[model samples]
Target: MSRLIKNLFALIPAFTYRRSHLAPPVQEPLLANNAADSTVILGAGIIGLSTAYSLSEMSKQTIYIVDPASKACVGASGQCEGAIGDFGVENELSPLNQLSYELYQQLAEQQSGKETFGYSGMDVHALSSHGFNSSDPHLPWPVQEPEDISNLPAWLKVPRGWVAGLIANQTHCARLDPPKFCRFLQKECESRGVRFLFNTTALSAATDASRRTLTGIKVLNKGSKKAMNIPCKNIVISAGSWSEKVFSTLFPSSRLRIPSTEQQPAQDWIRLKIKKPRRSEAGTKGSCQQIWLSADSEDLDIHMSSFLDGEFYAAGGFVDLSDIPDTPDKVTSPSHVTDIIEQNTREFLALGLGETVQAVGSGRALLPRLTTNLPIMAKAAWDDLFPSKTKLQEHSSPIAARPVGDDSDVAGGVFVSTGHYLDGFALGPASGKVVSELITGQSPSVDLSNFGFPKADEESGDSRDN
Candidate 1:
């Protein structure tokens, strides 16, 4: 029944945008005059939305999510693969990964995630061309579904040099429609009194006299070209790749900066439908099982395969250094970029499979990334933003002067949560929970001591980064 439900949900097609407005939509859920207890989140991507959703449960302060995009999740999170599993088990972020995976389970139970966001556990079949017996694995090993590569449908293929094996079983992993899950999160956030300010750009931030804390932000309505000040108690920047721009604009003279060498990393996506649907044990429609195979090691390019709503999903291909646009709506792929993904998808299904499929719903989405490949999930260091002029004379390090493990009231501060790259979808919930915990002055479920703001003084050139 679970498999049946998954296929059924996948059969329903994903939605596309239809811009009905000559201009973008108006901002909403604006706080009343003289309000100073609200938090303004600086992006509607998954991280910001998740933060808002989690924050709503912890506080009654009027929450406003501001985004330059007309709608939420138009960036990385909205277009994620939604394939989730226990990641970082052996790394520094293991606790964070495990905490997020558990939160996903808890949230699924609380929100009927299966129905709301199509969350369900599934075994991940890993395909590799390394050898007959797999070599050193890049992912953690957890098996629930027994290996049955021989029984795979004709539409699925095991390339000439590749052999298939179960890497993660149902107990450790799951998949969902990312777009659907994002919309579901947005609705949940809205229901909890979180107001969304779509088509609104956060121009800059105002700080108090001490230059230590935030006062509010100035946002411009794209449609009306009108700028307004929205007073807030705190600020959260989950602006993905745009975090640096927001930070620079907010604190023009601040020495602090988000790592920003990378730009406009995109994932080319395509969906294929089998000409003849296969059947399963109970005579229900069987979609193609998920398979991921890396074709390159240096470039790290992999072919992604999964089934959603009767369509085989493939999303893997990386583009580098495209111009990062001013807004999410303005982001686009280079011509024929998705054609490569579509071409690859058709070729993979036909390789030794002799099955024909229809490829559709092809597009590319710009992803958020950090050069350090780690998330900056901490509050802005008050000292870093305003370095003491006498610091060098006093021989004091600004980085050392900053506070550590601060869980105090942000009454006039800001929080930054971005640069998860491909793991953004899986990590969004935990990041949101942590930010909410920070705002509420509670101990974070995952320790963020290492994921602090980067400082030039650090030997690694990034202060406890990633």
Candidate 2:
């Protein structure tokens, strides 16, 4: 049934936008006054929409989401292969990843009958040259050896040089269609009175005279030659890789800067629709399995998964950051990146399993750090925003004491939630929930000490908080 729905959706024109299943048709033009008294959320991706939806559920305040795209999930969120797995088991972010997984399970339960976001349990296999072994302690999930290789699908032909494969506990991993999931979130937010300003670019944040408190944001309507200031009590920057650029423009002179976030060279993937062979012909059930492959000699890792419609997606390879232009066209895939991914795909699946190529694409994500690999999610530092001790002490009390208002409040407020890197989708829900807690002055559910901003004296050139 889900596959049928997906195929129906695939037939729609690529440029045609999906309407909100929950919100009423937007009847008013996006005016500054419409956002007055709203909690303005920047960026309409998964993080931004998730935060907005969480905020709307908790607060009666109007919610306004701004994005340059025509709809949500048009950026990295859309490009993601929705593998909701706790891939951080051996790292500092393991707890957070687990929390996100649980939250996703809860969300799936809540949206049970109304919509299908392509959620399903599946086994994830890790392939390597070392051969299958259950003794690997680094993998958090239980591992088991397959009974025989004869039962495996024909498309999963092991590479010539690889000898080992381990399957993760089937309960630990799940899959969803990211684009569809994001649209569901948008619909829920809209039903909760969230207003979306699509095709709107947030140029900068408007702060008070002291530059301590954010009053509103300056936004430009890309469709019309008009600009306006939308008064907001609290502003959350969830703009993914572009968060730092937006933050810098809003507070150009602040002593604390979001460390340079670099864009990873793009990764490309090809989607192919194939005809499933008969069980008699393939000698098996013909189930599509997800595969992860890595070898000691190869620095790159290959990830492959298949959809219900017999469409397989395979992605691999990396490009040098220096080779990409600052404002390169994002809609088009780079030839070099595509070529490398194609080569990797062919090497991984040597059987040529597909009947027709459906789509080819690439994604370049901006990571918060090139070093310690931790996401930044906290309030802007006082000293960095207000260097003068006298001014800091003078405005500190009032800024902290100001009460929340419908339109705008004087209390200083600037929050950042980015730098999740490759785990953005895996961690996005939890990140948004935590950021909302911070904005609302509620205690965060998780200990965020590791995710906080570095003190001025201890700051390094890198973005790592540790």
Candidate 3:
């Protein structure tokens, strides 16, 4: 089997367990002779399936979802360590993120009947020994007045804030069992007449005249590698992290010139220094056990859960990235990953947590790597030469087209609901509904002009074609 296929199937056991109670493989296709439907969704992740569910409920058109995976959510959505807090988007809490939180609330209530989509309230605590960097030239924020660090310890000189605690007390974020959530949406969509084609790979999207609109897709059966062509009126690209690949094929020129920007909000480049406890004290119940630091150095985002007086208390530090890198490869260096983890571990040591470090795990994020320590909701016009898209206001000129803009200018009917990043779990429902409105030519319940297509006049200054 191809390496890709092998990796996909290897995840089936884990995927099946999370979504449903299933026996071993049946050794048969889920849909042997089923035919394609009208509206085809190109992914089986939360975004794709959620989009399908919304379309199935709001329109008369049939919906079909195709994925190259052995089961649903096996990609980024299924395996993500689901944490649904709003701290990252606090600065840019657009209507999009707000709506997402609401949808998650509704799903929580509905799923209560079956205890499906295991949902829980997440408490967030944004801690920092030192505040954000004001003079750092790379930061997007304007420098404020200088302040004194003389009274404070050198390490704790950075200002600290409880951003997460405030959000939890005020906004109420929900944590989801991602696998369960994906399955719930899948079953719900299927019940509404949306068909799923697991293990079915879509190789390419074929467009009609004008070369701007998509007409159909060329796909293959994963097990047999047999190819087929399925036509459709619309296609929603929900392939996460890998989305650029699809978009590149759709707009080769844009791919070469414009480039899909990296969405990781932080560079993951903080340094970590850990001091191991003495082995002689290992057998003691409570020897000289205490984590201490200069009180200036702390990672605000990484939390440490510890046992204290029969209760659990969490603490950590925060250090924001200066800007969201435009290329994943640029920010995903080994040192970058090591720095983030090390910094996080350093904070744990400072807290005097457990003696021996238990474990560590990390992965790429979907959210734009942030520097302002807040969510971004602005939109800007497409400019290939600019190297980056700006998050401007709703009335900003050159309104940003949806990420699915590759064929949107041609399809004229296409729209997208993405960039939720870490907010995907909270915002998927609302985003799905809004996208449905755009797809059906109806006004969205929310004001989405910030994400709307730009007018001809707005494009006048654009000497670029992307």
Q: Give candidate 2 misplaced runs (Cα > 4 Å).
A: 1-27, 30-36, 113-115, 129-147, 151-154, 159-164, 209-212, 261-265, 275-288, 295-301, 320-331, 343-357, 360-371, 381-383, 386-412, 456-466
Clashing residue pairs in candidate 2 (N, C-alpha, C atoms within 3 angstroms): 37-406, 37-407, 131-164, 132-164
TM per prediction: 0.80, 0.78, 0.56
lDDT per residue as tens, model 1, 215-264: 77899988889998988768898888788888888776667778754454
Off by over 4 Å in 3: 1-37, 79-93, 126-167, 206-215, 251-259, 262-301, 304-413, 453-466
Best by lDDT: 1
Worst ten-residue run, lDDT, model 3?
A: 1-10
Clash statistics: count for each candidate: 3, 4, 27
State how far residue 438 of model 3 sits from its true place (Å).
1.8
Tally clashing residue pairs in candidate 2. 4
Report the C-alpha lDDT of model 3 over 158-212, residue by residue, as the tens digit.
Answer: 2343111111221443355555677778778767767677667667666543333
Candidate 3: lDDT of 222? 70
The TM-score obtained by model 3 is: 0.56
Better of 1 and 3 by lDDT: 1
- Identify the leading candidate in terms of TM-score: 1
Task: Name every residue pair that clashes in candidate 1.
Answer: 10-308, 10-309, 11-309
Which rank order by lDDT, best down to worst? Answer: 1, 2, 3
